[model samples]
Target: MKKYLIVGCGFSGAVVAEQLTKNENCKILVIDERSHIGGNCYSERDPNTNVMVHKYGPHIFNTSNKKVWDYINQFCEMMPFVNRVKTVYDGQIFSMPINLHTINQFFNKNFNPKEAEEFIEKQADKSISEPKNFEEQALKFIGKDLYQAFFYGYTKKQWGCEPKDLPASILKRLPVRFNYEDNYYSNIYQGIPRNGYTEIFRKMLSHPNIEIKLQTKFNESFNIDNFEHIYYTGPIDAFFNYKYGRLGYRTVYFERGEEIGDFQGNAVINYAEENVPYTRVHEHKHFTPWENHEKTIYFKEFSKETGNNDEPYYPKRLEEDLYKLELYLKEVEELKRYTFLGRLATYRYLNMDQVIEEALKIINE
Candidate 1:
């Protein structure tokens, strides 16, 4: 039988292993530095409240792809979920994604969809025909007042840099609506697994041909001669031992607390003001609304530069980082026996759906 070695037991690694076991007569060995199978998406019930807590903050599985939705549904039941995120600005609560309701509330004016659109158009900067950076893109789309109130402080904290310093493509994913649709994601399929995310991983990796080893870190010295091919889903820079330079990344840490009844009364609430140390607060109970719990557990999320000990959450793909990535890609092209996939391996800020799509596509290739 053909043999293969896969590093990192996250979605990328799991999806590949699950598909390869069915497609080929092969024995696959999967290893991860962490003791968990789900990686950052790992979730378990809190002993205190019996609520499913997302260990690495909130992750709502949302995707427009039908194939991905059907594939994920095979493992676990996805509970219907709509993420209606709210933001606290200047002691006032506002609907997120700057919808029609948000615009009226922010300006203290009752305007219909058409009126709101016209007003925002006037507010937007007319001088700049094209936007060069994140700040300019916001100013062009929503104007300075709304951008300053909604995006400025929160973005500065989340990215750990001025909005102008970031690329314009970074802000393109966010949608601005003219209607009262408060669903945070515009995707057709969106939900949280009925069982925790970890359970889904357990089901995906249960094939007899797949052998998993947790807490086994891969390095340059690891033998590769036994396997036909090696699939690496870890950080690209780490694979080469930082031969070029360490890529830039932002990591997040959480402060946890428990409440008697309800904490935030919502899944997530962003603190838009700069004075607030944490970017957003998440109530774990709200994620799985179908489940009942007397006591509630919440986490305050704080974002900062990736430290040596921190697990890199968001990739900081500035000009310097992209330049470093180009050098790494050149090195990747020369290798024949290795395949790199997923967000960390490719060094792109990707959503969960995108990651799964890439994994499915890579395996077929």
Candidate 2:
């Protein structure tokens, strides 16, 4: 029998398994080094609260693709969700993305849309005519007060590099608003899977042609020989044995706590102040607002450096890392019958829906 192997059970791996299984001649076996599937978007029930908690972190499905949303609907119903994020700094909670309301609250002034626009113009750092780095870009756009409060410290702690060391592309992700809107994202579709993310992955790979092996790590020498083709979702640089040296990345350490009721009454709370140890806190119950849970679960997420030993999460795409990735590109070109996918594989951060959508496209291609 012709056999196929998937190195990881993430959405990327699952989508490939699903598409390959459609062929009656192929037998696909999926493997996840972790004891479970669903990659970082994995969700399960909390023993005490019975709420679906995102194991690695909160993974919201948000995208503009109707086809991707419809594809997800086949496995599970998605509850409508809006990512209303808040930023806590100087012991005050304000709306995120720095809208007109945020400006009013932060400055202690009642500035409507027109006034807010003028106020921001006055506050913007005029010294930075052409901003060179993350710090300069933020300062140029929002001025010292807003940049310091919302970005300066949080960004420094997150990347362990000064704002000058980082590129301006990071600050470009932040949206500036002249209106009172505070929604974190402008995406059309946003939601949490009604039955949890793991259930969706489970259903996606449940076909008889697919065999999932949990807690089974991939050993290329022995395992790769057994399968004719390989779809490796593990780290791309790691696959090349770190010949040009390991790529730099950031890993999040989550501290879970039991809450009697609600913690922040929001899904995500970003702590922009440098004094705070953790960057942001996620209230799991807030993710599923459709159902109310008496108890809540919250996570205090902290950033750490990703090395050869640590499980790579957020790829630190700076000068040095990109140079190393160029070397990885060479290694990938040298290979045959192997495709890398997902955050670990491509070395980039992505939301759950984006991961699924990208994987589907890869499979279709």
Candidate 3:
């Protein structure tokens, strides 16, 4: 029987382990530095309020891929969810994605879809035929007022830099809907696991052929020669001992608190002003609307440049970082008996669905 070592018991590792177990001849050993599974998506019930809280941060499972959705559904019952995010600017709350309702409310006009589109086209910076950075992209897309109100401050705070310094590709991910749709994501399948993400991992890794070891960190000490293959879901730079300079990443710090009643009616609220220290606030109870909770638990998210010891959340793929990532890829290609999987391994920002889809592809290949 071939023995395999998988690092990080998150969705990537867990899914790969589950898929590999079908072979029956493969024995899998999964490890994570954290005490729990699900990696950043780890969720636990709050002792004070008994509300299910995302330990690292909020994670909503939204994917258009039926295979990916169906695969996760096998482990836990996914309750229907649609993230309707709001933005607070100048003391006024507005719908996200610059929808028709948001456009009408922001300018105090009852313009329809055609009129709104024409108005925004005029607002856009036509002079910039090609956008080089995030600021240029926003100026060309939504114009000054909408960009400053919704994206400028939030982007600056989230990336810990001015919008102009970041790539325009980042802003392209956020769509501008002309209709009244306030649902944050457009995916066909969207929901949260009723039993929490940790439960999903528990059920996925329940195979008799797999063994899980929590609080175990992957390092140089591990005998790579022992396992037939190794699947690493950790930072690629860290795996190579940072032979090349560290790839840039942004980390988040959460300020958690419990409240008697609903703190924020919505699950997520963006603070779109540079003066505001935190980027967004998340209400845990709102995540699982299927269940009722007397008290609510929330988190105020703050973003910072990832430090050596800090847990990396988002990859900062600037020009220099991409250059470093290329060097790491070269190193990865030279290595044998190893495969890098997941967002951290690939050094790219990926949502929950994308991560699972990629892991499934890797195992299937």
Candidate number with greatest lDDT: 1
* Model 2: lowest-lDDT 10 consecutive positions: 217-226
Provide TM-scores for the models.
0.99, 0.95, 0.98
- Clash count (model 1, backbone only): 0
Query: On a 0 to 100 scale, what is the lDDT of residue 332 in model 1?
Result: 92
- Candidate 1 lDDT over 54-130, as tens digits, reads 99999999999999999999999999999999999999999998999999999999999999999999999998788
Candidate 3, residue 348: how far the Cα is off, in Å: 0.6
Single out the weakest 10-residue window by summed lDDT for candidate 3. 169-178
Write down the worst ten-residue block by lDDT for model 1.
167-176
Query: What are the per-residue Cα lDDT tens digits for candidate 2 across 135-251?
Result: 889888888898888888998889988888888876666688978777777888888888899998988898988898899877646447768888888888778777888888888
The lDDT per prediction is: 0.93, 0.85, 0.92
Model 1: pairs clashing at backbone N, Cα or C within 3 Å: none
> lDDT score, residue 157, model 1?
97
Better-scoring candidate (TM-score), 2 or 3? 3
Model 2 ranges off by over 4 Å = none
Task: Count clashing residue pairs in model 3.
Answer: 0
